[model samples]
Target chain A: MQRAKAEFDATGVQILAISTDNLNGPLAMAARDGLEFPILFTALDPSIPQAYGVFNLFGDGLASASVFLIDKQGEIAWKSIGKNYTHQVFPEEIIEQVKKLN
Target chain B: MGAVFGRKNRVLIAISFVAALLLLTVACGDNLSGPSLTSGQQVGAAPSAEAEQPSSAPTPGAATPAAVAAVGSESKSNTPPATATGAESKPDASAAQATGADSKSDTPPPPIATAVSKSDTSSAVAATETATPTGTPVPAPAAVSETPAPTSLPVLVNTPGPVAMLAPDFTLPSIQGPEYTLSEYRGKQPVLVVFYRAYW
Candidate 1:
């Protein structure tokens, strides 16, 4: 999202992030990272994560750390499932791979 | 005691003699069989060459002096004819050319031309047979536009219920310090509703 914002400033590629994280957590993370994109909270809805297949059945019923590259056709082009929440994908690789689809 | 020691020595000598005879036999056998086995292998390998004779014999006739000269001129001319058989025989022509050059032949064969001609012919034939035979001439590919057309925002469908969608209609305090409802902004432009949780 950060790379997209930087590289595609006038290209009109808007980044919309959906999070199942609690209000405070998502807000604090966004603020800390200085995110200019819109991060929407699903109001602790379990169905949202289940629908996206990123739902983890553990404590707090939080969504797993997964990166999905949805193409312009609304098709999932690439997806990565990280075992741990901290094992997130690099933004550069995602941007690079997304550029190929374009 | 002396008789027993002498008897033991005699037995040892006999054993030594037998061992020497066995070694001599083995050595003699190797000398006699080695060359004969090699000759037998040569005889076996001769038929393989004989089998290859017909293929090689036809090639020289097929690659006549006139044909070789034509190929040489084609290679020098830089316009190779396309043919499948010509392509297949290119490597042979190339090798022959190389050998001819090494042997200082008066006329060096055009090896590359022969190969290229063959490839071109085969490729042309294959293309003609398999390619889409549309009656109309193929139009040139469309030029890519520098500026892409503006994409319309996806229409958010409202399910008939009170269920909160991603961009639910709500009256919220705007960044410009005015209370805004989604319905008010509906006619003018697309309103992106972002429901954010406050940390501070």
Candidate 2:
């Protein structure tokens, strides 16, 4: 994510990450990963995940690993809902799809 | 004497025939004019002239009639101005030069923000002089530009709130070490609050 942000800094794209982890966990993760971008902690907020239609109730009782490509027009251009965290989509594919939007 | 005269005559005739053939070859070559030098020159020169003429020149008359229609279409298409037929005549070198010129034109001179800190001595003297001139009263210099008033950020609307059907506002510490409230940040920038399990 940091590498992607560096490449896209001048392209006027902003990335905001949100995690359901507790405050301490998210802060530690940010510090360890050296993440320069913003990360919002939802404090295990199930409502947020459910609203985005990514909540996996049977799996982890949280949102699945999903990538949503929202275009400049605020429309969802592409979405990939991975079944498991290990099957998460790559960032390059997300970028490729996003580039087509603009 | 008869035999010698006949041999001399044959030799003279052969030499004369050779000389006449050489002269004829030279005359024929000169009159042919080597396949029209002017036409060859025109063929070489035509490409350059065509290149100098803008690619759109042929379509200019048609373009004018649809100028109004094109303006509406162009904004939606995000067509590159560089690809326009009229712009193609510009050589790549000139295009680069034009880009540089455009960048320079668009860039404004640096504001006095940086100079304000370094020239404190000069500013103090100037302030003293101004105070002296207006002995009765003088207003302190106010900032010309306020910290650009925070812009209203976009927020996701029509999404269910934290409460049933009501999007609940929450506060979370920002990665920048400042605590941010979703409702507050929403007024400045759209917030996409994703809730994902870290372990899973």
Candidate 3:
């Protein structure tokens, strides 16, 4: 997603990644990848992913890979839940979904 | 009468011992082979079950034990799952960069890789299992843009209204030390919320 930062910025979409990992893991990741966006961790309460319906979707005791495009009104405009835990929606596909919103 | 009772007791004891031994063997066998088989089955069944989740009215309290278990195991297991190797390369590099960027001596990369690699292998497998194993990592599929979004809208979770449903409000802390409320972004700018199974 770091690769598409410029494109996402061009579209006025704010990218927020919720990491199921502990705080340090994503903190280390963002720092290492020079991630321009915020990578939030649910250390305070791990239910955030469950709220999103991404948690334990794979039953591997982990969140399933998923994406939600929330419009300015906070309603989900489009979403792609991975066919499997490993099936991630690519950044370009995300950009395409965002374009559809406009 | 005493002799008959003794014989019956001996027969019963022998039968019970045999049954116990059989159960022991079965239990041991299951322990030896169950993980891989169960994991495979769960992988196949998960998608079908997950597809139905969005239609139900989700309660924030209906969290699963698996999610809690994942978090509990997060700090304990340092060894990466066996499946991690095929897909650990990219994240391992990023982890190395993380190690350097944070200048912390304690953070080991393997655990993070291990937790994430189990599922990530699916994508890698999806990519290379049918196609050639290129040195390149996951490429942004720009060409795929014209195609009906590469991922299916298999699940429409957390939506209730005829149109779009308001995302459940959340006040999560970013790694950068600020609280982000999902509803706060309402009327501000479109937010793309990506829930990554494991990222580090």
Candidate 4:
């Protein structure tokens, strides 16, 4: 995600990363990795991710690498959920998707 | 007999010290954070073409050139351990193990992360849950929250959700910071929401 930060900024798309980590958890992570983007913690309702169809319902409340490109109208313009955790939706393709919405 | 044994012990200690120092030297020379300068030239666009866009097109996909540097360094610095371990194990096995250790040790953070994730992967069920085309028949974990499972969560997200449809607006708090509303970004610009497992 850091790699695509500039493209996101250029295209006027907001990037919000949600995770199951608690407050201190993501704080420590952000400081350690120098993460510039906002990392929202979803520890309270574990189902926030569930609603998005990214939460692993079968395991502890953990999220998959699910990405959604939301247009200005708040609708999902493009989204992807895959079997491979490491094989993330390519940033280039995301940039293309978001750019298309503009 | 005592004198001979003492001398051998001293020799063994010295050998251990030399080997440890050699290993430290090898480690101190390799920088794991940035790509090797040697790779700077060979990596496409790193030299000149897209230097201005360091983070965009060039940096994220650096795994390739980093792998190249790893290969180059492995071939060169992998000799010492083979020689050291040759005193015990066969040269071939020790050499292989030596290269493996070289690769593992030089890359510390990733190994630690993988070790951690591997150990606690049950928290994620390895992410190959059903409703998808994976082989696992792993039963869904006992649902523990008030949030109801979306009908489209498991098998149905394959189709893109409609455009201009109201997304699930969220009002989640940041780590020790103010709360954010997902819908706030609407009517202004595009918003890309990224949902990941954990920061760890």
Candidate 5:
């Protein structure tokens, strides 16, 4: 989220977005949208999203949308899996959650 | 015996024809309507399942977000945030920047892939269905499909562990040169991993 970049960086929180699209698509998105963070390309394999459990329910590649808040020690601190794809984890909410982890 | 065999053969032929027809219909959903739908019809087709996806082929700047991509990055001077946008404009500048930033990244060959195959692959989705006739391009909330009411309800999916459990550690490449490992970032600082469906 380019809009929340300052806040995320201020908190020392790194943001990474992994998509099933090729690195090219993500690269395109980053440049056009002025994304300051990292957006990884998964190619055809859904490893990142699958492990993150975005497709924990139904569908293929990327299914249900989800956010994972993993702590410094790589423990599950908080996770919000949207009921539907459109339900997003807002920046303010994430900012609060990140602060609590500190 | 010959008459009985002929009768059975005719029944099998009829069944085969029906099966072939069904497959053809599903496979040709795009051809059936995609071409006919002028930009005018594409306005409505944007959100329609008939436009479910051109195909799953990975394209640079061509993945469709599950619903909407709201990448309207406003002026956040100190920190640059990547807001999602529904429009999938060509990322000439971004791709160049990406290549410039990361030397380690093996530059992917420019797609000789015609922009036309986009009808076949989900990649190449320029603007989303919500991209208005007015050209303002609104990022509407992504719905699962034409009828999203059913999927809007909660459903079960596998998790490495519950909220308190240790997250599974794995490595994924960063768009930049570095590789992201869950374990590496653990002791240093908090990391949030966001998996977007695709970029529309």
Candidate 6:
């Protein structure tokens, strides 16, 4: 994420990272990892993850890692849902999906 | 002294055997919980999909992709083979179930907004065949309009274009500053939303 932020920004794509952790943990993580893109937390309100159909997906009372590419018209252009705790979409796959968009 | 040492050795062996039994019991317990837990994940999408299967089969325009994505992702940990196979057969119904499930969060199925490109319409037609045989051809229009026509239902959305599922709108506080609303970026820029399971 740190490496691809500038490239994503160049393409006018905003990267928003939402975590299942509470407010403070993600805040500290952003500071620790030097995450420049916006880091949003869903601990206070979990409706966001639930909306995306990923809340408690792994049965650990937490969200499975996932990614959604929302087009300019607010429609989901591409999405990859994590099947387990370790699953995640890579930066290259994300770039590829972004390129597919108009 | 020799007699006493022999007795102590027997006691040590007994203790080790008891410890081994306890470890095996815990391992077996986890094995038992594993299927139930994984099946719980399947239940989230399957039951709902199964419930709406009959009604949602005809309208595969906008919902096909989402259903395909859901089934693809969950295929690996498919604990219940029955639901997985059933979901695979008719993903369009699962798409409606997905919309219904997420409706509480205000994430409606994507409204087919504009004319689908020739290639897209062709592909959507191919996809529609998996859901229904008598798929209606989507009417590709030339005129561009800013306001999306209120084509919400599958019965009424036959002519508009291919369906695109919309992301649910959300507003949440960020580490950077004040809250961010997802819909605010619509029509301005595309957004990449990432959900992470923070280790901390």
DockQ of 1: 0.05
Ranked by lDDT from best down, the candidates are 6, 3, 4, 5, 2, 1
Residue pairs clashing in model 3 are: none
Reference-based lDDT, residue A72, model 4:
88
Off by over 4 Å in 1: A1-4, A8-12, A57-60, B1-200
- The list of candidate 5 runs beyond 4 A from truth reads A56-58, B1-163, B198-200
Show where candidate 6 strays beyond 4 Å.
B1-162
lDDT of 6 by residue, A1-102 (tens): 777777787777898888877677777777788887888877656677877877776677777788889999999888888877778677878988898885
- TM-score per prediction, in order, is 0.33, 0.37, 0.46, 0.44, 0.44, 0.48
True contacts kept of each: 0.00, 0.28, 0.89, 0.85, 0.76, 0.89
CAPRI level of candidate 5: acceptable
Worst 10 residues of 5 chain A by lDDT: A55-64
DockQ by candidate, in order: 0.05, 0.13, 0.32, 0.31, 0.28, 0.34
Candidate 3 lDDT over B1-200, as tens digits, reads: 12222333334433332332222223222323333222223333333323432233142211112222222232232122212212423333332333334222212333233332322332222222223333123222211221222121112222232455677777777888787878888898989988775552
Query: Candidate 3: lDDT of A94?
Result: 89
What's the best-to-worst order under DockQ? Answer: 6, 3, 4, 5, 2, 1
Please write out the lDDT profile of model 2 over residues A1-102, one tens digit for every residue: 556765545444445566755578777877887886678666676665555556663476766666554444343446666566665566676666656655
- Identify the candidate with maximal TM-score: 6
**DockQ of candidate 3 against the true complex:** 0.32
TM-score-superior candidate, 1 or 5: 5
Q: Write out the backbone clash pairs for model 2.
A: B152-B188, B153-B187, B153-B188, B153-B189, B154-B189, B154-B190, B161-B166, B161-B167, B162-B167, B162-B168
lDDT scores of the candidates, listed in order: 0.37, 0.39, 0.50, 0.50, 0.46, 0.54
Superior by lDDT: candidate 1 or candidate 2: 2
Model number with the top lDDT: 6
Cα lDDT of model 6 by residue, B24-77, tens digit = 222222323333322234335343443443355665433333332233322322
